[model samples]
Target chain A: MKHFAAALAVSAALAVPAFAQDGETKVIGVSIPAATHGWAGGMNYFAQATVERLEKVYPNLDFVLTTASDPAKQVNDIEDMVAARHVNALVVLPFESEPLTGPVQNAKASGAWITVVDRGLSVEGIEDLYVAGDNPGFGRESGEYVASALPEGGKIVVLRGIPTTIDNERVEGFQKAIEGKNIEILGMEHGNWNRDDSFAVMQDFLSKYPQIDAVWASDDDMAVGVLAAIEAAGRKDIRFVLGGAGMKEMVKRVMDKDTMIPADVTYPPAMIATAIELTAVGLVSSAPVSGKFIIGSVLITPENAEGYYFPDSPF
Target chain B: MKSPKIQMSVVGPVLALVVLLVLGASLNPSFLAWDNVTNVLARSAFIGIIAVGMTFVITAGGLDLSVGSMAAFIAGLMILVMNSALPSLGVGIPIVLLGMAVALAAGLVAGCLNGILISRLGIEAFIVTLGSMGIYRSLVTWLADGGTLSLDFGLRTFYQPVYYGGLFGVSWPIIVFALVVIVGEIAMRSTAFGRHCAAIGSNDQVAKYSSVKVARVRLTTYVVLGLLVGVATILYVPRLGSASPATGLLWELEAIAAVIIGGTMLRGGFGRVWGTVIGVLILSLIGNILNLTDLVSPYLNGAIQGAIIVLAVILQRDTRQGQ
Candidate 1:
């Protein structure tokens, strides 16, 4: 049934070009990472929804959406879009920066407007637009929340994400935010932004530190694991855990005023929607959408948690 | 000298484990604490349980790359089953039992499918499992709708004890892992099935001429491994009460590495259930110790783990050379 509707939509899109003789149908290709994790899954959901919605709103614009599991596959996807589809614009969330730079540049060389999302290309100026979530703001928002929550400046442990530039930037921003505060970091370890890894790491941290006042899980998935470990340990020293990425369940916990999960920070996966929409506007309209669009991360407290709650979103 | 060398090779994994334990204890005062000890052991349970079954499969000259992905798929299926059944069964033991049954059944079917494809169709074990690996991973991802499949909150709370609670001081996973190891060791050493596995792995044509049912034994090995993966998933689901695309990632490599580290040959023929247990413990301890201490940079954790795995295998290899 769903595929039938999709086929119908494709047919309708094809018919639009025949009637509207004023403008030739423009093709916009969107390339993103496959939904391998919660955030990417949410990103995939939003990207697909945006493409479907935009295809209806703009009759003369057609979209080619491709998801790749790796950098090589992503590069191939872009090359195929440029060569086969003859896309007028390319919206890509690179799986990695270094490998995607050359391919995206090649797309630009083909006279396609290139919009890079999240991770930037290694060499700048190739992309007409850059859309990203504020990594530093993500960490700072989380840190600022922790500071305000524990005004006395207590000791906390941090569970970091995978070792990457994004992880590094977030951690640096968090450290800078909490630098003047009296928060003593008991320990820091990479949970690799995974639940199982964080669970094990948090368990070990529980064994190592007897009086951890709080935890900075840094990601919602890791927070789930950290919370489970702390619950199993039955430790009373930890007051609350601040998780970022605004996953639905965590936001729900904040909404209910759960003490363990007092707050969350937003690094929304829906930023992909923003990127795709801007690129669509550039292709169909005369709007100048050729600048960096960084979505600032916001702290989601209980009062504002309801607003950030995306119950329908998979994340 | 030959006798001593043989003894050393036999005890290589044991020696490596002892060294890690001592190093861990010396580095941190709480490393040997009861809680920390249980934490490490329980954490090792999933891979430990899976590696025991891997021992049988390897003994029978088969390899399974699908166990990890199979576990993920089964967990997803179990969660879906249990969640849907919650309306009728409520949030009690019956619902949990139903979930476990679903897991075991799914595992049985998945394993049987792999067994049939490889044993009946004459496909290579590596190729068959490699194909199933991609298939199972994609299935789980599709089942999850590219997100996570989480068990209902009420059910998760009620079922949490399976993972966190245990008789006496040991967690359930550790208890289950210990039981699996004990049975596995006995099977590998005492049973006719065990001898047949060794025979088949060492030389299948010779074993066939010896009147052993080579195909059945090979199929049974896969079936056992699949069932064990289901058991592992039962414990895993309750821990997080969720399954995602990342669930059980790289677990096959870890299980295979443990099997090899414990003195099981990758090329098949010889196997040891007890050694695989030790291998599981060794891998768990490396991660635990790295997390417990800031001795080296966190970035080098993978490098350090690789070095230790190589060192442990080399220790056994040198002793085998003397034979």
Candidate 2:
């Protein structure tokens, strides 16, 4: 169960500035998942920071932000916003795709501009704009890095995230990119995007295979687990571990040029801010910001790690 | 007939574990490798250690849904204490020792809170722990700001050996688990306290009539469980070098599941410490074997795990009936 208190804590931070829509002031309701995990925590931080920054810049724009732990709570949150808050526009990062569709569609019927972020809804035409991080690109860039780093070919293992369409897309992109390469994937297993689970999976991988040249831990959290297991095993053969989703700690490692953590890939949670900004622009300006906007996954190398590192970010 | 319940508790889980190991070995020869065996056993340390305490809690007719969250909360506090003290303590043995002391103390306090509320205040264990579960999880989330808390890098290398290090050729976590299980089994079998727990769980009214000090025994069980969780955190943080707010998510369920699968009566009275250890191994082995194979889909793994748990429970039920 999601913490109702945390949801309240997130919304309470941004609920003070109650502004009514008059000449150009538009109320934008921001609904996103609560900080249940590291990624979601980072998303919430960015969402709050962006709202705080934008409210000052656009004096006529007001944001009503609410965080929900589950789909049902999120649905209730949206319905409440549409009914009572009288939101002119809604920017939502759904807790899950299917559950939020009907509620969002209902909001849309009430004339709210729907800006969906990250996970897409089952029904396509309901949203006016879509902003999402590139899942395939995240894997493809990670694959491209692996291919280039081990040009001589090596034995690698994969620690996959949760079994979802996103995971499949990342794996597909990775496989497609490394199709003809000599980098043989000895094994692949799900880490469930959890640190402890990943640690256990990596330990088994280390024991099962005598020689593992490198690792592709798709998510940063799992990458942390993989690194810990490798260290605990005191294995010396591993050249480096590539983890995606530029978590600050991982990025810091890259910046420090740590041997085990050579680089990283970006699957930023700040894409919510992008959605918020676009929706705000659409409401205030004459700009037509409709259609899918996929953020490219950028590879974080030693030289560029500092640019991606956000020390203040919760993640 | 008197030994039948005992046989069901000991023999059943052992059989299930053996069958699983044999099946895994047949599926993949590498699953039987010495290193794989050690790795799987060592990885079970977290759940194994916690399940020891769960044995007491469940035997005393109590439930603790807060163990997982308490682990995370306590782990977070330990990391914070260690990091802040690292500079003054100079990355020495003293800091590590101090961290352990703090961890144990924090666990005892947290456990006592749950125990006192349930035992003294007359609240149901389930309701008390479920409330504390939310409280503990939220506290950790707040502590980490919903992120991660890593120990000082200077000490990370030294602390790594606590988990990764071993005596002679054996891994440390495995050794630790063995020690804990031995101690736990001894306490639950050889002591009057152990008998009191069984008496309390079997029937609180009967235990009270016998002048067993039911509240005191029940409260002590929770405290012991918390201490065990503390020990788990010590091993866990050293391995990961960080504690995320998500560190112990849903671990309480796994611990509870291990306890039940080990033939511990959920309604109270029966507990098998060794069986609990086997139960934990069974759970870890399931994940390990699944990971080793290419046939099982990742999504299907959860369903498979659920099926095994149900099968184990059913097997235990049948064996109990034979008595």
Candidate 3:
């Protein structure tokens, strides 16, 4: 155990000198939530791809990637990686906003430039760069797209994500966009952003409502299950189904002209990769990068689904 | 024949199902529709199978927390396997059968490990499977590199038919679930091993003296449970065309709930295969009925599920201890 720690320390030390001289070998620390579901899983994928591409393009650079299932663990992980990997700069897609703020602040305090992705802290301005997909847009776009298609005001069921500010923001935005629209929401329930859970929730919704015009499954994983349950019941009244997070399967559905999946809402996982790239560039290139990088969530209609489709991406 | 406890055991769950149906229909007239009723049964298949295996585990006085994650892991691995084979094999029926066989073997091994650790090594079943649960979940996540294990379109139709098809008027999942119930019932009744399982669960010391192979039975139950989880995976993965760690999150609790609510003792002695089947159906039915209704809030759906499960269980507990 002692030898393992020492080896990590030595390698970290060896890599630091190389990084300091050129600023080219700047260490990129990629912290993402563990793969409990599809979205985070895809984020990890892009994080990895970004690391390899940056390393090959910039020979002096190195990448250190880690994951945590929750905010508390992520804080501890940051301390561990900074010590063992000699991360010169940090890129974090936190598990939660508030619990992670202190740890991120500490990393920033120690001279590492910070790039925060997705979730934002309740306390602001600690991060040197902030990158996120607009959550409100996720809700509003999905609500607008689906509601527009059902102009006659059809009944719809909604499966929500976990109770977080992001979840709430999306819900609020969606509800607002569809406000005064003909859509009567049959019910809204938390599927906790999962396929099987959504399947259960959708099954319940199907039994509860005699007639439903559509479904807005807030997230892709839930969208997968809701569509499955709907198909099993052979319900045609569910004119279209839409979900946020450009999961490859959902994107593919739109691309293939599947009538039920007329469109999708984009909450791309690649934003983390984008964050890491910006942080890496900030260290070496002397580029003027000060503003918050808010990636727009575009509605993926059939005409635009090909642009969002990633045949190679596991998500 | 033997004072009819067995027949009553079977009848209890059926009676509960009828009550649920009546209550559901009374709450909303649409619940009785053939489409809604059939949909609830079809959606219940995953838990039905897991609960069946859990019926054996709990009745044998053991627990397996890894069942859900094990199901997800096997599903992910099977999809990965199928995806790899599709390019080479050109998306045929034979490849799917081969994939199923491999996934079943992996699940059986996982179960056997849980069994041997608990029964032979004398480890607590809870702790053993709890530890195995983390390991299995981590393995699947690592294997997929934290991404979805989607079946590409080339072979989707070839394999999709299993979850999508119906036998007579029933869904394929329901058909598979009924087959599991039948096999489980026969195993519990006619097999020497089945009698020994009951004897051991009732009293291991007494069972040992009575020439029951206590260790063998306990060890094998895990494998049986594992195989059932594998079967559940075969039906499950195609539903979404992918598997993640959340695939079977907290499912063991559901399966244990089904077994206990079905009136099986948590200790090692009793089995209620048919009761467990209905128990699973009731769980799905509660969720379905709640969603279909114009409930004040969807959050109530969980509270309702929890309430019904607790009520069913308390009712079973009171009745069992009555005589």
Best by DockQ: 1
Interface RMSD (C-alpha) of each candidate? 0.5, 1.4, 2.0
Worst 10-residue lDDT window, candidate 2 chain B: B1-10
Over 4 Å off, model 2 = A1-24, B1-9
Query: What's the i-RMS for candidate 1 in angstroms?
Result: 0.5
Error of 1 at B7 (Å): 1.4
- Deviation from native of the Cα of residue B163 in model 1, angstroms: 0.7
lDDT of 1 at A158: 98
In angstroms, the error of model 1 at B174 is 1.2
lDDT string, candidate 1, A255-289, tens digits: 99998998899999999999999999998789899
lDDT of 3 by residue, B1-323 (tens): 35555455556667777888887788887778877777777678888988988888777788889998898789888988888887778778888897889789988898889989999999998899999999988888877767767777667667777887777777788899889989998888889867877888888899889987889999989999999998998888767777777778888888988888787888768887877887888887777666666654665667888888877765555346543
How high is each candidate's TM-score? Answer: 0.98, 0.94, 0.88
The residue-by-residue lDDT of candidate 1 on B92-188, one tens digit each, is: 9999999999998998999899999988888999999999999999899888878999999989999999999999977899999999999999999
| DockQ-derived CAPRI band for the predicted complex in model 1 | high
Question: For candidate 2, lDDT tens digit of each residue in A1-315?
Answer: 233345434444444443333444578999998787888888888888888777766766777889887899999999999999889999999888988999999999999999999999999899999999998888889998999999999999999987888999999999888878888999999898889889888988887788999999998999989988887677999999998888999999999999889999999988998999999899878999999999999999999998998999989
Which model is ahead, 1 or 3, in terms of DockQ? Answer: 1
TM-score of model 1 relative to the true fold?
Answer: 0.98
